[model samples]
Target chain A: DAGITQSPRYKITETGRQVTLMCHQTWSHSYMFWYRQDLGHGLRLIYYSAAADITDKGEVSDGYVVSRSKTENFPLTLESATRSQTSVYFCASTITRYTGELFFGEGSRLTVL
Target chain B: AQTVTQSQPEMSVQEAETVTLSCTYDTSESDYYLFWYKQPPSRQMILVIRQEAYKQQNATENRFSVNFQKAAKSFSLKISDSQLGDAAMYFCACMNYGGSQGNLIFGKGTKLSVKP
Candidate 1:
């Protein structure tokens, strides 16, 4: 495909368990981002990567870890999942780090119990 | 920190009619970017339109257009000849300039319903 894709569209995990959300983009964008969407909060950024091996924390980065080993893949990991983490996660990518449009994935709905 | 505000939590418009969704933002920077994104039940964030702060003219794309009032810091989206397909959650986002990296700050979003 020519767009961004997220794996495991629906995931259910137990509290304290580790879960990883995978994000892949075919455009090879330099900037990749992870955001969690919830009711009343809209979307909050968790993490973003400028390029391979360069990543930074966003507005809501606690409990979530992200790594970008390659330009096409940026994965987010939850070391110890909590019930509060249950929400729809979105992955986005842009061709430029300055001024560019963002292409989003279908999203991953993670339910923690 | 820059913040985006979408005042209308929900709105409804009849098919083939025009509807405008309001958005306001707070930022001290003179140069920046604004955007309107649509998310349907499929949960895909699609860019509907974008506007540059420095530009005086509004940006339009097909049936979608924006009313950008830089002095008031307001950016409203106007959808002409609304269709059922336009029903979705619309979010307004802001991005500041002069930063080494670009990250969007989004509003709570407004849910638009197109009635037949």
Candidate 2:
């Protein structure tokens, strides 16, 4: 795809299981982000990477882990998925951090039991 | 910490009419950014419009325009000649440069319905 793409558009896993959501962007943007969308909370940033190997935590990064080994790839992993982790995950990228314009993926809906 | 609030949880408007979605934010940073994003049924987030806090002029893009009030910390989106395709969940977000530049604080969102 020419734009950002997310893998496993729909996923279902049990509690205590490990799950990974992959994000790939063709734009090679410097900024990549992971956000979770819930009912009342529009979308909360889980993690963001300024560049490869440079990552930072967001508001809700307690149970999430992110790694950016390559500029085009940023994956989010939940070592031990819990019921509270059930939500739609979105991956976004932007060329510049100043403008705040983001291009998001189609989103991966994960359901944890 | 910055917070974005969209007071209208749900709004309905007739096709070809105009509708305004209200958003308010609280931020300590003097210079920041405000944005409106649209999420359709496909769950893809699309940027509708953006406004810089330092700019006094409101931003207008086609049928979409934003009224940015820095003093009151209000950023409202007005969609003119609303169409059926405009029906979606609209989210307002804020990003401060003093903090993580790319990190955005999003509001609860307003689900807009267009009646044809």
Candidate 3:
């Protein structure tokens, strides 16, 4: 109840439909990151936010849009989901950018049909 | 850019036995941090153990210990008295402290199976 949580633990969407994964953390960590895990590739960072209104691209950010309006919430949206985008998305939070351990959520499993 | 590599894609250990998972990294910076994370079927990334590069001593947490060779740039995890709960994917990660921001660069991961 007091940790990072991702909504819609399991989701199925059409290839062209829009989908958004919500991530919320109660720790109020300054750094929030979104990563996609797939076979062979492992975990690849999609986007990261240093603080409110401050976000940066990661290894794979294409087709993914992230916004951090509030420190507790960081949402990742896919404008048009694709079959290639089907993977497990994880949300993590860190108290500081200098040195801190990351706390991950349960993960959101997305299946694009 | 720092790169972490886990040579063994999968490994199996009998219950109550010991097993070691190998991890190697390439980095120019001397000061950094290394971590081992376990992702079970639940998909929650849990920090198993961590080692600071500056510390010459290895880091250990109960049944989990790291054999960190600074010179070789190798960090392998040894799990003793393995249990069925130990069955999961373990990932080795590296974080460079010399950089402006310390972001973790993770390896592909090694899946460990605990056999009865």
Best by lDDT: 2
- What C-alpha lDDT, on a 0 to 100 scale, does residue B56 get in candidate 3? 97
Per-residue CA lDDT of candidate 2, range B28-113, in tens? 99989999999999899999999989999999999999999999999999999999999999999999864664778899999999
For candidate 1, write residues A1-112 as lDDT tens digits: 6699999899999999999999999998999999999999989999998899999999999999999999999999999999999999999999875574789999999999
Clashing pairs in 1: none
User: Whole-model Cα lDDT per candidate?
Assistant: 0.93, 0.95, 0.92
Question: Could you list the iRMS of every candidate?
Answer: 1.3, 1.3, 1.7
lDDT of 2 at A37: 99
lDDT of 2 at A69: 94
- What DockQ do you compute for every candidate structure? 0.68, 0.77, 0.61
* Residue A99, model 3: Cα distance from true site in angstroms: 3.1
Q: Which is superior by DockQ, 1 or 2?
A: 2
True lDDT of residue B17, candidate 3: 100
Chain A TM-scores in order: 0.97, 0.98, 0.97
lDDT of 3 by residue, A1-113 (tens): 67999999999999999999999999989899999999877788899998899999988999999999999999999999999999999999988765647899999999999
